[model samples]
Target: MTKAANFIWYELMTPDPAGAASFYGAVVGWTIAAHNDAAVGGVDYRMIVRGDGGNAGGVLALGADMLAGGARPGWLGYLEVADVDAAIDAIKADGGAVQMPATDLPVGRIAMVSDPQGAHFYIMDPIPPEDAVPGEGGVFSVTEAQHVRWNELATSDPDAAIAFYKKHFGWGQEGEMDMGPLGAYRFLQRGDVMIGAVMPLMEGYPVPVWNFYLGVDDIDRARAAVTANGGTITSEPMEIPGGEYAMNAIDPQGAPIGFVGPRKS
Candidate 1:
């Protein structure tokens, strides 16, 4: 099945990709591979392989030019679409802005865009390899570890944001969980599975952002690894549905990250 409107890839843009490799390798148990693809603009881009040997995403090294140009460490997800150009057009018409013009790569055509509310993400129409199995999805999974488990958005306007995404990406606001004072945590579903949620921007976040959650085997162990490897646990894991725990953190390089798993410890 074509994953239109679904997340097809995840990426990390950090000033220190080497240190990020060590940080994430410890916290998430990912093995970073050295890949020198000159087509990638001569950056030290590395593929992140989970314990299952399948890649979950890539780590992009932020060049000096990027940092000097006001780029900061953050995680960006790629939302797959049927037509990259058409999507860009719609995004603009709907009050969104294009941060980077659509660029074609060997893998597929991609473009960095922000929603009307200013939460940034990518939209791609990937070109699968000849050996790629038909209709198979990678990187983002609902029942896998290491791969991104959920994609959450913290925006200024939850209602308008939901409407904008629904109108453009074919996403459905299936249901919501009440969060009391913080407002409702509206779940965003592509089909039957709940991919993630959208909520009001929390106290310290200030600006709108996208936070992708990485699945782990043990939430406590993952928290331990974060502090051990120079990362900071900003939120303690709280048990969610299915008895799993989720928490937020800031990686050593200042990129915000999240994790979800059982408390085996």
Candidate 2:
């Protein structure tokens, strides 16, 4: 089993790139730029980042081919894998589905996969000589900006999901936290690092889904900024059991996302 590195980038394939970029830029104070080139198969790509050129990410033009194939507008997280081919094989062996076979990128190899329970994520082998810079205005931040600090999988079978991931990614369980009416929260760890958690979706909630946590210094300010832009608040800022605060919001295109910070004691 190979040790997984931190999340490096996040990408979105949406039907309307311009609209999606505008919504995220206004909501998150990102500077959106368009990239058009004959390289990368001659596709039109767009980049989004904070004004400071930190916390950068990307969006792809959700063209007719993608739409015809049933790709919806949503956020996809990219995890650093030691070997892209091995990761894809492990994913398939663990009951996951490979949406896209491994493809080589300028940086490294990448593949999009859905876990056994239907949660989607990406695996990438970073271009060895061209490692991603932390906090470099990208979706997956490390040092300069807050990268994805946490990920949560809301699934019907938490134990099964845990077991599958443990076998596939060498992740270990870190006990469970009480979520009151929401039941217990199961934490997953890799090596000495806590990567994310797994939990049963609240009763009557939607099907299993993956949630990414974006770090922020001030929850209120972030929430306010979200609304001031074209985004809408789906949930008010609330403290979880362990003293962390979070809130949900929809990007201008109605794709949902979350923000978190230290809870006030």
Candidate 3:
């Protein structure tokens, strides 16, 4: 049985899909194409295409009903599991909750779930297409530009969050960085890869959530493109241990996003 280890896909839910497509096209260099779905009465869901023409994830236009349900424009990640329904059962057994029950799409079976601390993400059992490549990885890549580079989680309980994921998803705590008063920034590993880190949930985030960082060629140039395209920078570029720079920003409609790249002066 394969455990859920990687965040295989990412989706940004915004009220303005075309505008988001334009914004990311400038900032992250992703091209979007509308996915014609007969299921949701043809909802405006666009695919995020990377430079290598691989699927990064999607940009979904939030409907009025979704907005009324208090859905805001934010990015969410999807973990590929062997069985979506079984994954939900295990999540519940481990003190997690399912926001959406298991449902079958044209492509796969999926359910929305949260850890015990309430950080939400999806679990899916994908049905590969006839032309799909064997063992092909999804949206995330540690070194590829225009792909998700990191999966940072600001959880209410870092210790418990780390334990839960390790037991369920085969993740391990690899290292630690003491952030003085903000709490420990502990690294998370999936097999041999350092996928991301977990930190103490900060002051303003109402709930625990995953912040996926996309890769760019140059941090400074991407920063300028963000402001030029109507996004707001939340955190200024900060140099990390690897000598790369990372920063946080929000889309024009207020969806939080992150970027990682070289800081070229």
Evaluate all candidate structures by whole-model CA lDDT and list the values in order. 0.88, 0.71, 0.88
TM-score: model 2 vs. ground truth: 0.83
Steric clash pairs (candidate 2): 54-137, 55-137, 55-138, 56-137, 56-138, 56-139
RMSD of each candidate relative to the true structure: 1.8, 3.4, 1.7
lDDT for each residue of candidate 3 in 48-151, tens digit (9 for 90 to 100): 89988988888888989999998899999988788788889899999999998998887788899999999999987877779875334568888888999999
Candidate 1 structure lDDT: 0.88
The per-residue C-alpha lDDT of model 1 at residue 4 equals 33
Minimum summed lDDT over a 10-residue window in model 2 is located at: 135-144
Write model 1 residue lDDT over 119-178, tens digit each, in one string.
999988888879875334588887677989988999999999999888888788977889
C-alpha TM-score for every candidate = 0.95, 0.83, 0.95
Better of 2 and 3 by TM-score: 3
User: Which sections of candidate 2 miss by over 4 Å?
Assistant: 36-39, 128-146, 203-206, 241-244, 262-265
Name the top TM-score candidate: 1
Better by TM-score, candidate 3 or 1: 1
